[model samples]
Target: MLRTSLTFILLTIIFSSQKPKKNGVKDLFKESFYIGVAVNGQQVSGKEAGALPLIEEHFNSLSPENGLKWSLVHPKPEVYSFDFGDAYVALGEKMDAFTIGHCLVWHQQVPNWVFENESGEPLDKDKLLARMEDHIQTVAGRYKGKIDGWDVVNEVFNEDGTFRESKWYQIAGKDFIKNAFRKAYEVDPAAELYYNDYNVWKASKRAGILKLAKEMKAEGIRVDAIGMQGHYTLGGPSLDEIEKGIIEIAEAGFKVVITELDVDVLPRPNNSEGADLNINFANSPEYNPFVNGISPEAEAKLAQRYADLFQLFQKHKDKITRVTLWGLHDGKSWLNNFPVRGRTNYPLLFDRDLKLKEDVFAKLKVVSKQ
Candidate 1:
């Protein structure tokens, strides 16, 4: 009886000490993932400190890619404010977590005035292309060694798996993305460069990316990785597609990542009054249970979704460079105001009550066992 009790005690101590992954950075590149979150003003406050402890529990990285966009870092020309971004990076460093700069060039966030001439008319091809180059050089150059990687570009594809028309494409033609890569490399050669997009597992978008990658390589441009923006609904990509996609990306000379991941649980049956209250969640063919709020049953589904993904992640650990969540918790998520407004959505690995959801906790525990 004494022997049994002592054995149990020893096991508990060993498990407690090694609750987090044993190797922090060593095995990171090999069969490891970088869980992370996006933060806003509320998260930075003292009042919310206790609410964010789960961060230390799961994440090993920080991505304020949105917080450091053109609007915040340098709201105007010539002046720069690293206060917010620096704080986030400092947190990452303190936590021994990896840090990533979101993007150097994007079509949406730039002030409208950037595209206009003195008379307020939009710039022509030559001028717009020049502007794009300057934007890339300035942002990428500033963060040089500090950032491990840059998104380079984001959401360049449409829902039906098509590239949207943008000023970059209009002015520099196809060379805009290529030049963005070239200039980012020029400033910070060591930083990993990624081609990030949504719905990347689909046939049309992935095929276009293949063509784009070939074009870039032919022009001597190197794409270091592919960011599969995993902002998915209840039924994300099937297990087979994920396996095949990861293998294919690595085969194409790029690393794979589950970027911008979140499993949104929005109820169905279309509350016509709440029609627009949503995030990136689509309203059509509504889910059967109407995931208005994550019930105990809904939590089970959410947990299973993460577990299944993590299991597949284990399978492709060789090629997957990192796996990131879109935000820290449900409360601060942009999902609250995005595609749908006034609706409460539970799309994170944790619940709103700040308690560990069993499924998510179980998934991490599974990761630890390996």
Candidate 2:
């Protein structure tokens, strides 16, 4: 454990922007990456308006991937709920941050009651497509020019590069993805529409989606960007693999976003065999997930891992436009209850106390290039 930490820190000294250099990573974000967050509107620590301060501090954008979904937007059918979206947009405007409306269609967040038939089955192709059109138009129309982009479709791909089995796919057929973008464009042709998903960096997976995008363009539909949901686990993929994927996606002529970024530390990783709850993702979201705890040595190497990735972002700034962290701090992070059930995962830029974790601050300094 000590050896790994030492190696990472040593690399940070060499790769970090802490070195006295002009035109470093920080300078780069001034134009691109408009650092942002995936935030929720839940009450937090006596401050019901959560994560707003962090947004003001570091981000130039805010994306409510789940908050802006169908259910959240319209909890009761036909009674639109602008309370949550309003608060987020107001904060973004006040902070001079770009607000991104995360999705128009998602299989998970929408209530099953709306999309089903009278018999409790889903609607037919025609009805399904019309319902989708109505929903997208209403939501995107309400926000219209204010939103920077929309992940019109989210996570449409299975991990092994297969199209997900969704109701949109079932009723509207393969045209569901294209139609979602079309509806978004129809509501606000000006607002950017994108296909957002995870694990897209893999060669075969990226290729499959790129081919679909090409076909969509051929059919006169516009897919303005591609969002890479960067929910990374320990040993998920190599740095080289991740870097290459970013370059290729940009090369395919779609804007790329690191939409939902996280690095999980769970099941103790079994190597160092630290105490079950010793390493708190809440304290440091970017702790080397593969490693067990935070040390001067681990801190250094984790810094480098962040630095190296930021370097990639720097290299492809022309192609990549935004790199939004999953959350502002560990306090309100969904990682706390996701995938592990009763496990707290820290995989973000700030700790629960709101101070920058060594890894997060170091990475920000790298991205800031100061």
Candidate 3:
């Protein structure tokens, strides 16, 4: 009996001494890539006090959710707001996290006055280009040396790989894209520049992006990475397509960053895809069946989906630099209102109470080991 007890104690000691399991997402993937999260103004400013501890523990990189957007930051031609932006940068510094500037040019959320003349007509090419340069220089320049990278342009290409006929395109054509990158580089040459977009898993859209990246490279513009927005659903965009997109982008000699990743588990209204802010559907019971909370079966599916994605990310860790989730927790997910309004969406690694989804997190932890 004494011998048996001694053996059990020895086994317990051996197991306990082996090594504490890595629980933090950043720690699990420390050797793979930077794990990141986007923060809103409240989170950065201590208004969302619960989030700061979670952010510091699990994420090694930071991206401002809406504070850095042109509409919010600049608002009008003569006015510029930096309170939230300053707080955001300060939070990154305090956490020693890799800081990212969201974007310099995007069609959505930009003020109409940016494209209009004093008479409220469209500005010509030269005037528009000047306006673009001024905005880029002012914004990018303010955060110069502080921000590690900048999404110089975003979602400029359609799914067919054609340039979106946004006001930027309509006024200045492709020069707006090139000039945006150029001005950002001029302001902060040390910062890595990126072109960010969604639905890049589509072959045509991926091709268009690669073509543009190559064109910019050939023309001596500095583009350090391509930000593939991984706003996925549990149902579509086969893993093969996502893997192919990552391989192709890396093979083309650019770092691939999985930006704004979230897996929506809710039913879609019209089977919509991608992260287009304009895509909105009226809320209904059928579309939001999980008002009380996600079903156990659906939650299991979400865990597996996140596990598979992390496995893929781990497999290609050498090619990917950063993987940033769009928001810190489900309660704050833009998915809650996006595509369908007033519907509760469980689309992040954390639950509504700011607790990590243990099942999903465990699966992801196992993926890191694999």
Among the numbered candidates, top TM-score falls to 3
What does candidate 3's lDDT look like per residue over 1-370, in tens digits? Answer: 9999999999999998899744678998999999999999889988986889899989999998888899999999989999988998998999899999997899998999999999999999999999989999889989988999999999999999999999999989999999999889899999999999999999999999999999999999999999999999998778999999999999999999999999999999778899898899889998999999999999999999999999999999999999999999999999999899989999999999999999998898789888
> Taking the tens digit of each residue's C-alpha lDDT, what string does model 2 give over 1-370?
9999999999998788565533322234776577777777763122645455545656677788477888888665567888777777777677677788987888777788667876988688888788778888888898888887888887676556677777767677668788888888888988778888777777777877888887898899999878877766544567778888887777877778777776654433333211122233333333234333345654465556556666777777888888877876666676665543344455566767665675556565656553
Q: Between candidates 1 and 3, which one is better according to TM-score? A: 3
Compared with the true structure, all predictions reach lDDT values of 0.69, 0.69, 0.93
Looking at model 3, report the run of 10 residues with the lowest lDDT sum. Answer: 19-28
**What TM-score, over all chains together, does every model reach?**
0.82, 0.81, 0.94
Q: Report how far residue 275 has shifted in candidate 1, in Å.
A: 17
Candidate 1: minimum summed lDDT over ten consecutive residues — where? 270-279
The predicted structure with the larger TM-score, 2 or 3, is: 3
**Would you list the rank order by lDDT, best first?**
3, 2, 1
Candidates ranked by TM-score: 3, 1, 2
Candidate 1 lDDT, tens digit per residue, 1-370? 9999999999999999885744322233234666666665455433576644566555677677367777776676566677777666667667677777786677777676667788989788777767767877777776667778888876665545556687666656676788788888887899888888766777677877867876787789878889887766666567777677788888888899778877766553442211122234443433423445557877777888877777778777778878888877777666654555445778786667765566576565666456
